[model samples]
Target: MSTKTVRVLALVAFLASALVPAAGWAQQTLRIGELAGLTGGIAPYGVQIHNARLIAIDEINAKGGISVGGQKYKLDLVALDAGAPGEAVKVFERLLTVEKVTLILDGIYSSVEYALGPVLKSKKALLIWSGGNDPATTVGVPNAFRNHFDGGAPFMKVNELFLKKMGVKRVATYGQTGHADFKRFVEEYLPKIQGIEVVATEWHPFGEKDFFPVLTKLKGLKPDALIVHGFFTDGITMLKQAREIGLYPGPLWLNQYGAAPLMMDEASRAIWEGTYEILKSSWGVTTEAPERSRKFFQAYVKKFGERGFGAWAESGYDSVYILARAIEKAGVVDDPAKIGAAMQALNVPDVPELLMPYKPGKLFDKDRQAYPKIIVSQWKNGTFVPVFSDFGQ
Candidate 1:
């Protein structure tokens, strides 16, 4: 062949190589990191939330991966068990530095959320909080989005209701000391309510088996109502001991954390028969929620028995679906800024699966901060029921 013809052949070969795409360049994988407390005082909540997330992911993947800007990307969930602050920090560091996840979905508890806030913000990761109700979680972190209502909001409403509607003048507050958010709910919101006087306030360690001492002190005060905040185990123990010691049941028992459905099953029906609980709407109830909530409730019950629609499970399932919606709306998973903006823009016309009915135009605020609507639920006749809501009945 002539020299010119040989050079032409070489040029053609180079062009063909450049035109061919690399082996792994067809699709990009989007990873979502989850740091849940799977082993601790709140392990049951962590387990249920994790299960809900898995269900959401499975449903989404079954229908095919999320679509972004005309391209489909499969969700890669990296779940880590970080039950305490020390473990949570390590997991956050790994997710940020090693896995390099652009989105983080975890932090069921306030302490873990607060501890992971700085790292997530510094890394510019979109942190979707499932259970951090502390106002401090949203204080300065623009990247952090808490789906759960602020812990103070429920307590504030309950305080007002008890003092104004229920005609309760004096009340005693009890909460778990180890949980920072619950403690702050007592310190900040409980003290601010008018009309109702806090005659006494007590704090117990997270795993305190004996509540007789605290119950003794609370009974002596003889307050009109008792506001108790603790896990299901502790709450059950407190109620059982309170009844066993012949503590007068004249004072109404008001529980903030005991609103979980599992608590009803764990505690005797007689104990919770007439007890008033201020909580999020029950996942089992569909009368107040939208069609999606009803569908999810039925499906969960069908799959996992009647006890599937607990608070933790609902919150967990909602978190994943909301994140998927945000990602779809954003149209770009590579950019955290875009995803964060999309998350703020999400507004569902009806309640999504396993979520309460968010008030109209009350999901996210002007500053991209979430203002969640809350409902007060009561346990009546061995079932969870929505009694009151800040938005409407």
Candidate 2:
């Protein structure tokens, strides 16, 4: 036969061999269900997490998804909105029994997390929590993992750093009524600090328009510091009213939840200036973190307009990527046990995108329980800058 004809025949033979399907080519796709509040009170945080998860999933798929034991499987994301605890429990039940999701990612409020704990424990579904910070959720649940730092621990740390170090002895506390977690932290934990006297504690109904009464009452105590714990809008309103009543200019005004990027804008900047906040992580600190975090920040700005990338946004973004990495290491899609094991074994050599400068084994215990260190961040010149670091000078 001629050389050209022989070459053509060889090419045809190779093409025919390639046409045959490989063994186990029809693998089932893996599904990760997300129960988020897309329209409720914490919708902004929920939406940011959901969008960041989608970004990670798309990037994984673009890289041809993850390969497990010689089979490639794509991720299927099922998102459902649960406006309240009752609705969240219903949605979670449906996701487990009906949707049969291999894994679940959710950031429902603390109340919803507590309500769904028993249900999730019974179902044995692996849960990656984003929003709930109550320590009770992590106490005995073996299948659950929390991505955000516990709120109570950080509050204590902030009090130690600011009130203790700055010599602010007497403090007045104010918060919303429905915030059981915050109140529990303050009442139970803050009093444990030495020489810190709580002169008065007041709780207002959520969404109460006028805070003049509360401010007037708190001002009457003549405390050395005023600590405010509430949602962004409520905190802003209280701060403005406190300023109007001449209750904020002299005392050290501290806030826990209101120092987020969205709350510290042009208008609120003057109001929240010099306010101390406890945060788990932040971007633009290249000294302690790996180069990947910087890359993630640049990519995020390039994709989404530079608007609301705060500490929580970084946590949400990193949570998805960390889960994906765990799945890749676990090498199984359907087995929750294996996935959980893989997550527990993950150790990023350095801080990656959405990750802080946390030690591997210390950050998460053997049971996948996380105990992240909290940093005291301050609003300096309209930016959230990390000022206190356990590892830094």
lDDT of 2 by residue, 37-138 (tens): 677666756666676677677777777776787777777789999779888999998898888885888856677888888887777678888766665776
In candidate 2, list every pair of residues with a backbone clash.
Answer: none
Clash pairs of candidate 1?
Answer: none
Q: Which predicted model would earn the best TM-score?
A: 2
What C-alpha RMSD separates each model from the true structure? 5.6, 3.5
TM-score of each: 0.85, 0.87
TM-score of 1: 0.85
Q: lDDT of model 1 at residue 331? A: 78
Error (Å) of candidate 1 at residue 86 is 1.4
Task: Tell me the whole-model lDDT of each prediction, alpha carbons only.
Answer: 0.70, 0.70
Candidate 1, 380: how far from true, in Å?
2.5
Q: How many residue pairs clash in each candidate?
A: 0, 0
